[model samples]
Target: MNPVVEQMNRRRSVRNFSGKPVDEVHLGRILLAAQQAPTSINGQQISLVVTRNKETIARIAEIAGGQPQVAGAEVFVTVVIDYHRTREALKSVGAEQVIAQSAEGLMVGATDAGIMLNALQTAAESFGYGTTAIGGIRNDPQAMIELLGLPAETFPLVGTTIGVADDASLAQVKPRVPLATFAHMERYDAEAVRRGVAEYDRQLRLWWDEQGLTQMPSYSESTAQYYSRVYFPKVAESLESQGFEFRDD
Candidate 1:
């Protein structure tokens, strides 16, 4: 197998860190990789706030719903979908209409942030560091904005924790749904989606059992439960408070 492909295949979310500091040189390279990720129309609306401060990390861990890795990792990079810079740039060029209040602008900023974060993750992994993306950063977007002193037209998108993986962090690769499940040809196929998810649920249950885990639920059930019970209940209000408007016009 190609080395890159092998590396990707072996990638897993590492929640336990060995407490070793990431090298400064490696950190610089990882930041450069993140900057090299493509942006929409070269807008470059993504910004990263790198933190190694113990107290701040601890506070962030608390904000992240008590995820220890957020505080224990060697470094934490908070990815921000930032339109403040672009809006200023537009003003600099004498463009009066600079506010990014549209859905397209929000999506572009978020997509750019995601791309940069993925690049950062890949770079960290290439340097033999373990990383996990933390969506819990959005658990309290308002608090994050205040704590980080983020300006207007900016919002926390996600976070990445990087560190040397502890021995216990080396777990088996988690299974994903079959490619045909989401990768459509020309038209959407409902039957294929159902079949693929059913098969994937069975495979996931088996994988969970092999790992000495019980009480595994089907993918559809788990997904529905999570969205209906956990995520959706809070996300909309948070996003709206952060100045995101999901306008259909």
Candidate 2:
């Protein structure tokens, strides 16, 4: 496998850090990778804020449902979907700004944010840094906006913590569903998914059993444990609170 793809394929959540700050020079390279990521319509509707402020990191951790990885992180990068710059440019030129009010617009920003995050993680890992994406940030979008001082047309997309990995926190990579389950060859493969579901559950249980975690639940059960309950209600409120309009029904 190619080195780049290998770096990307090693997807594990690093929840422990060494409490050491990252080198600004290396961080600059990661940020560059993020900036170079492709965005929809060349709009570049994204911005990232990097900080080492202990207090801010702690607050973000609290806001993210007490994620210790965030609380202990030496570097935290806040990625947001920012239409503010484009809005200002449009206003200055007396052009109508409407994309910020629809489902497609949000999709563009979120997709760009995701791409940028992948680039960030790959680049950071290349420098021997550990990283984890915090989806819990969506639980309190209002707090994120106020804490980050994000302007209208700017909304939190995701967060990342980068630091030296603690040896103990380095766990084995978790298994994922088979490639044929998701990556169809030029078409959707419903049958592949039907077959892969139980296979992945078994694979997950075997992995857990190897770790002496016999009581651990299967993939579908674990997934349902989270998905069965409604989560991130704040995310919906964010559409209105953050100056976004959602029209898709």
Candidate 3:
């Protein structure tokens, strides 16, 4: 396998940061890599709000369930889905601007932001920095919006903490689903999921046993429970507050 590909394969989320500032040059290079990530139609509808302020990072950490990793990181980058820029561009050209109410707009904004985040993470890893994604930034979207001073049509979609890893940080890489079940060739295989679940459960059980832990719920069992109800009831309201509409038409 290629060296970079190999690094990606072995990469795992790390939550323990040493609170050391990333080198200025490395940080610039990492942002440059993220900027180079592909965007739909080259619209570049995403922007980053990066901070090295420990005080602000600490406050954000509290909002995100007090994750120490976030509070201690040297750099915290917020990936925002920014349609505000689009509106500005339209205004600049005296073109009529339209609000995004359909699913396609949401999909494009989210996918573009997510791809750029992957590039940022990969570049940071290449420079030996530990990285962990912070999805909990949306726990209270209104608070984040106010804290970051984000304007309408701009929302903090996700966050990433970057810094050196502590020696006592997480080291185990979680196992992924079997490739056959995860990826299909030519045509979809309906039975692959059934077989994959059984094999995955068995493997997970063995792993727990090796670690001297009791077996927990199987992957399907846990996922089914989690999806049984609407987990984030405020997400719709949050989106609306940020000028995103969900219209039935």
Instruction: Give the number of the best model, judged by lDDT.
Output: 2
Flag the better candidate by TM-score, 1 or 3: 1
All candidates: CA RMSD (Å): 1.8, 1.5, 1.9
Q: After superposition, how far is residue 139 of candidate 3 from its true place, in Å?
A: 0.9
Candidate 2 per-residue C-alpha lDDT over 9-45 given as tens digits, one digit per residue, 9 for 90 to 100? 7868799998777998999988887789899988889
Model 1 TM-score (2 dp): 0.93
lDDT of 1 by residue, 37-111 (tens): 999988888899999888888888998889997888989999998887887888898885334667787788788
Each model's lDDT comes to 0.85, 0.89, 0.85
Candidate 2: lDDT over CA atoms?
0.89
Task: Indicate the residue-level lDDT of 233 in model 2.
Answer: 79
User: Which of the two candidates, 1 or 2, achieves a greater TM-score against the reference?
Assistant: 2
**List of clashing residue pairs for candidate 1:** none
Candidate 3 lDDT, tens digit per residue, 33-152?
A: 889999898878899999888999998998887898898899999999888998898899998555456577788888998998898899999999989989888877788889889998
Off by over 4 Å in 3: 211-217
Candidate 1 at residue 197, lDDT? 85
Sort the candidates on lDDT, descending order: 2, 1, 3
Q: List TM-scores for all candidates, in order.
A: 0.93, 0.95, 0.92
